[model samples]
Target: MRIGYFLSSEEYTPAELIEQAKGAERAGFSALWISDHYHPWVDAQGQSAFVWSIIGALSQATTLPITTAVTCPTVRIHPAVIAQAAATSAVLTGGTFRLGVGTGEALNEHIFGDAWPEAEIRLDMLEEAIHIMRELWKGGVVSHHGKHYTVENARVYTLPEQPIEVLISGFGPKAVDLAARIGEGFVSVAPDAEMVQRFRSGGGNSRTCQGGFKAAFATSEEEGARIAYEKWPNAGVPGELSQVLPSPKHFEQASQLVTQDMVKKAFVCGNDPEAHLAMIDTYAKAGFDEIYVANSGPHYQGLFDMYAHSVLPKL
Candidate 1:
């Protein structure tokens, strides 16, 4: 499997993100995955750079391909605007940009005081938004009047030589089916073989499947776990709470129930190259074509060095 680095916009400033992108490229990572968030999950992560602005900077800073580990076009931003931004990004990156989209969390999409749609409704809106974006990318005046959105004589002027590949992120069966039906590729954060098989058998055959996992690098495993829990306790927030929580404070409140061990279980703690390789193998065995690893603390350079010297060489 191809190994890539995931840049956490929620945790890094714009300059930091660009530096990480450059570092990843130098460390021999194959690609990049950057998260799109309007707010840090619990404010301990502490930074949320505008993803498009960072993407523009990243294009100049590095040659590796980049994807928005997921952007939500259904709300917060209109699909039309996202289509234009993505087109410009693709062009800026010399056609190395792939738009990864999903039915977004309420934390980001509910900022306009819009009522959070249920999962089914959000999926429907996502389908419509994907259709509209794809239409706009065709280089014509698109006038879409769908059930959830409307576009009036819209066209994406700045486009790449090819239509930008759209990778859909899905965690459930219904969403996976939709991705299989419409998306050029699939994205997920889990190493679930069943879901990967479901996606392929459901019509995603031969499409790229990307998975990601988080790591917290430190001198010792316990120190790494402490850092992860302090910064990303929400990693242990179970069920639909992650999707439905509307604010950082709300997430902070919910995350109080999450234990440090829970967060540790979710992250690959410490600088053990074997642990990193085991995580990569898990994703590979689950049928992912590519895997992105994200670090959650100040020791990202340590993680990168480990990958370059020990982890990546073995792979």
Candidate 2:
């Protein structure tokens, strides 16, 4: 039941993110989760700093253990390159970093004009990418010609004292099985007991299971919901749309139908400490090893104070 702060890279500047990292540590969070995004989910979110650069800054900014909420290693960037970057990040954080990875979305991967493959194909790519990364992390030159990727004479010269742990993020059964087979841990946004059971049944019982949620802790519920709706209505866009949407503009257009009421239902808006606690309890009860929460608006300090004074202590 460890509680952590989630840094939303899409909404904050790099400097502000570093400050938030430090602030989170100071406010009694046990760890950190940072989203890795090349583009914002919607244009309203307004920012997307390079995640690796932020990781480098975070390694120096806070002692709190950090995880990239998830990074996609299969497309836009080659697996070998991501392996090198992740290895360097592990070293930079003194082994406090865990690499959380996934199959990725069109929003980020489509930038290089690569055709977004079907979900099944993407999973295959992710598995191969993981294998390539693990080999490079073992500290030797490696070469591979796989179905979806080719790595030639790749080696990571600098790595952490400990081997970096890789966590797989997924929501469905097939993906969960893949995580159990290869991942050192698992990650998800929702607290699904069945998913956790599937992981354990597939031999991931001993691995870390992490989840994340959002909160908009403003002075009033209406104000919180309004901000959340304005900034994150895309979150309510259901189904595979999140994975396949090609641009923020498309997302914004789709999210036009998401009302403030939808945001209110999805997020724990307002300054109610009890509501915040209840949201966290859902994840804790689901047996997550770690849970992280991100603010949906500019009032992060208020959220921190609420957690520090009221919410975190109860958990």
Candidate 3:
């Protein structure tokens, strides 16, 4: 399995983010996965830059391949526009970019005053969006009409040497099957083995699969839990339900239910080298083509340093 790095979009400044990307590449990570967000889920998570711009910056900063952990092409931005952006980015990055996409949430999508689409509608949108993007990248005029969208003749001018690979983010069975049928790669963060199996059964090939686990690392486990709750209260599962609920306060409220112990189980926390190495191994055993880990709390450099100096050496 290849080791990869994941960055929380809100966690660092653009310059810091670029530096971190370089650090990870130097540390020998095979690739980089960065979150795409327009707004921080809460005031606490704190910064969201235009992810495409950041992807461009990282392309210059490091050689590590970059992927949007998942970007919603159908909602905030038209797939045609995203197609141009992805194509240009891949060409600039020397074909080092992968278009990791998913049906997004109200947080980013609602910005355009567009109604938040339901799961079924989102999936439908995703299918059509993928079609639009792929065709545009083929380097000629293309137009598309589908249940959720219609495009006039459009073509991306600056294309990449290689066609970009599309990775679909999926969680449940229906989503998994769709990813299998359409996506070149499957992306997930949940530790569930069944999700991977379902993804494969649903038509997901023996292609690249990327999965991540998060941890709140600190000197004290109590401090770790506090940080975990602050950053991500909803730790156990993944989906859009938590997003549509009622308020940002609800996420903070739900976060209160998550304990440090729960976060620890999900991620190998603390300064222990063995613990971190084991966490990496667990994902490898789960058949992940790439395993990504992100630090939930501060001590970002510590975690990166640990991973590079000790854990990466061992791996």
Candidate 4:
């Protein structure tokens, strides 16, 4: 499986993130998966930079193939606008960019003052948005009128030589089916063997399948767990809360219920190379073509060095 670094736009400055991208490439990671968020899940996790700007910088800073871990094109931004941004990114990256899209969360979409729709409606919207974006990416004047979106005489003038591959992110069976129907690739947070089989069964046999997990590398296990709990306790927030929580403050409140123990259990914390490799193996065994690890703490250089020397070689 190809190993990649997950750039958390919610936690680091744009410059620092670009530096991390450079570091990741130097360490031999084959690709990058970046979070696209309008707000950090909780205030303690810090800044949320514009993901498109960071992608532009990363394209210049590193040769690694980049994929938005998942961007929500159904809301906040129209599919036409996302299509244009993604087309530009693909051009900037010399066709090494993949657009991973999903049904959005209220945290980002609700900021536009629109009522958050149910998951089913959101899925429909996502389907329509993907169709519209694909139409726009064809490089001519295109007009679309669908249930969820409308595009009138829209065209993407600056597209890459290759058609941008659309990767769909999904958690449930229905969403997985949607990905197989429309996506050239698929992404999910966990390594579910059943989900991979489902995607393949739905006609995604030859598509890229990606999964991501979190890790916190530190001098000691205690320090790593502490940082993970403080900065990413929100990771432990159960189920639909993450999708519905509208503000950082709301997430902070929800995160208070997430304990350090839970955080430690969710992430592979500490400097044990074997432990990190074991965590990555879960995805590999589950049939993921690629796995991206997000470092949750400050010791990224150490993390990269460890991965390059030990974990990566083993994989």
Candidate 5:
């Protein structure tokens, strides 16, 4: 499988993200996955740079393809605006940019005080938003008056030679079906073979399926686990909490029940290249076309170096 690096916007500054992009390129990573978040999961994680600004800077920093691990174009921003931003991004990246989108989480989208829609309603909005974006990308004036959104004679002026590909992120059966029906590709953070098969059977056959996992690279496993827990305790918050929680404080409150061991189990904690490879292999065996690994601690350079020498060379 193609190995890529995931840039966590929630944890790193724009400069750090750009630096990581260059490092990933130099380290021989094939592509990039950058998260689009308005807030850090918790106070400890800290930074949340505007993803578009980082993407623009990344265009100048590296030649590797970049995808928004998932951008929500439904609530915080209008689809028309996202279309323009994504179009400019695709042009800036020399057409190597893909727009990865999903229904988004309340933690990011509830900032406007809008009532958080249920999963089904959010999915409906996402489908309409995608339609609007695709229409705008066709390079003509588009006026859409749909159930969830309205566009009045708006058009995306600066577009790439080809329309940007939309990769949908899905973690459940309904979302996966929507992705198969509309997305050019699929995106996920899990190595679930069942979901991959469901997407293919539902109509995503032959489409690219990309997956990602988090790692905490340090001198040893225990140290890595400590860093992961300190920065990403929310990783252990089970069920729909991730989707429904409205703020970092809310997540922190819910994360109180999460133990360091729970967080460690979710990430490949340590400097062991073999462990990293095993995690990557899980995604590969589950039929992913590409897999991305994201580092949770300050030792991202260490992680990159390990991948460049011990991990990537073997792959």
Candidate 6:
């Protein structure tokens, strides 16, 4: 399995981001998936840096490939803007960047006072946006008027060595099917055998799977849970409900009903080396070509070391 690291945009500043990216590369991680959220989920999470700039800096910081875990092009930013941004990033990275995109969240998309579109509409918008981006990326003057976007007489001057790959992310079956038809790759938080199968059945290649999971590591399990529930109480929202509840408070409220046992089932929360490796293996077994670990809380350096000694050697 190819191993990668998922960085919380809120958690790291540019210098810290570079240090972590370099560390992951040295530690033998294959690639990096950074998030692009305009707002931190909530202040509990503390920060969400503008992602495009970070990708630009990371191009210089490391040689490992980078992909946005998912950026929403339909709502706040036009696809034309995202196309130009992705093209520029690909050039800066010398063709190592992939633009991973998705139908986004109300939390991020609604911040600009635009109502979040329904899932079906968002999917439609994404398809149209992808069409627009592709035309713009071909390095020629383009005129496009899609149902969701328009661009006229535009061309990317700083061309990439190649076109940026588009990776799509989605959790549900319909969305997964949509990705399979349109994406060069697919990304998801949890690896499910059925979801992988569904993607394959719907047109995604067997080789095009990437999965990520969060693991909490602290000196104390108590410290880890405290941090976990404090920063990500909404995490326990299972299945489709994560689609409806729109605020951090909803997560906090739903989380109050979540037990430590429940949280345990969802993440690796202790410092055990064997335990961490086991957590990573579960996703690999489910058919992920790439497995990304989202390091939890703080103490990132130690978490990386622990994984290197115990978790990584096993993988």
Cα lDDT, all candidates: 0.95, 0.91, 0.80, 0.92, 0.95, 0.80
Q: Which residue pairs show collisions in model 1?
A: none
Score candidate 1 by TM-score against the native: 0.99
List, residue by residue over 1-315, the lDDT tens digit for candidate 4. Answer: 799999999999998899899999989899999999999888888889999999998888999999998899988999999999999999999999999999978988898699999999999999999889888889999988789888898899999999999999999999999999989988999889999999999989979999999989999898999999989988899998988889999988888898999989989899999888888888989989999999987899999999889888887
Candidate 6 lDDT over residue span 1-315, tens digit each: 788998888666777878888888877778999988876555677778889999988998899889898898988798989999999999888898988999988767776677767899999999999988888888889898777777888887777978788989888887788888988888888869888888877898764788888777888767776666666665676765555456666656666777766666677676777776776778878878888887757777877887677677777
- Report clash pairs, candidate 4: none
- Model 6 lowest lDDT segment of ten: 240-249
TM-score attained by model 2: 0.98
- Score candidate 2 by lDDT: 0.91
Cα misplacement distance, residue 195 of candidate 4 (Å): 0.9
Cα RMSD to native, each candidate?
0.6, 0.8, 2.0, 0.8, 0.6, 1.9
The stretch of ten residues in a row with the least summed lDDT in candidate 3 is: 237-246
User: Distance from true position, residue 217, model 2, in Å?
Assistant: 1.4
Residue range 70-133, candidate 1, lDDT tens digits? 9999999999999999999999999999999999999999999999999999999999998999
Q: After superposition, how far is residue 209 of candidate 6 from its true place, in Å?
A: 0.6
Q: Please state the error at residue 223 of candidate 2 in Å.
A: 1.0
Query: How many clashes does the backbone of model 5 have?
Result: 0
lDDT-best of 1 and 3: 1
Candidate 2 stretches greater than 4 Å from native = none
Which structure is stronger by lDDT: 2 or 5?
A: 5
Question: What value does the lDDT take at residue 186 in candidate 1?
Answer: 92
Candidate 5 residue 105 C-alpha distance from true site, Å: 0.6
**Clashes in each model (backbone N, CA, C under 3 Å)?**
0, 0, 3, 0, 0, 1
Give candidate 3 regions above 4 Å deviation: 236-240, 246-250, 256-260
